[model samples]
Target: MAWVYLFLGGVFEVGFTTCLRFTDGFRNIPWTIAFGICIVLSMVFLEVATRNSIPLGTGYAIWTGIGALGTVAIGMMFFGEAATFVRIFFVLGLVACIAGLKLTSGH
Candidate 1:
């Protein structure tokens, strides 16, 4: 259950970041509101997840890992960002580390 919340928080972190990009430096009102909501909800979920079985360090690392990797993918696919091999390689490595942390956790 804590893992579930943690993963959800990570997912929302991507949404929050994407919405931030769409805000165009906060000039877009709707996207800015969405960004605020996403950030708030993501933090709430992270807090709850960390309060449960998962350690705060591991949970935060996973949350940030997902957010960074997902945002990069979304940027490449939708925002016309580059998809270089080195970037992809590092992203994969980050994912492996995140999975390892989850797998090796006491929880």
Candidate 2:
């Protein structure tokens, strides 16, 4: 379904973002390629997701919410980035917003 595509898109968004960090301004060849491929695939999935019944606002909000949370978690786990309480709270808020959008959108 469209929601599945949206979720996969979000996962690929996280993958590309993490690859961006590893690419180091595109100096790393493998990471750069990985990042580019992931980005392209993510966009493809997002486009497909948009073609279904879900409203643009709801789909995009959910996609971005998942992507943001996944990116931060990956950063913290793999890059030694801070996982502060405020950041966690903000991620929770993003989840709440996604839920609210889904409920109001009836999808």
The best candidate by lDDT is 1
Pick out the ten consecutive residues of candidate 2 with the lowest summed lDDT.
50-59
Model 1 Cα lDDT, one tens digit per residue, 1-107:
99989888988999999999889999999999999999998999999999968999999999999899899999999999988999899989999999999998889
Tens-place lDDT per residue, model 2, 9-71, is 999999898899889889999999999999998888888988877888778888888889899
Clashing pairs in 1: none
Worst 10 residues of 1 by lDDT: 3-12
Backbone clash pairs for candidate 2 read none
What stretches of model 1 exceed 4 Å from their correct place?
Answer: none
The local lDDT score (0 to 100) that residue 33 gets in candidate 2 is: 100
lDDT for model 1 comes to: 0.92
Q: What TM-scores do the predictions have?
A: 0.95, 0.91
Tell me the lDDT of model 1 at 43: 96
Quote the positional error of residue 4 for candidate 2 in Å.
Answer: 0.6
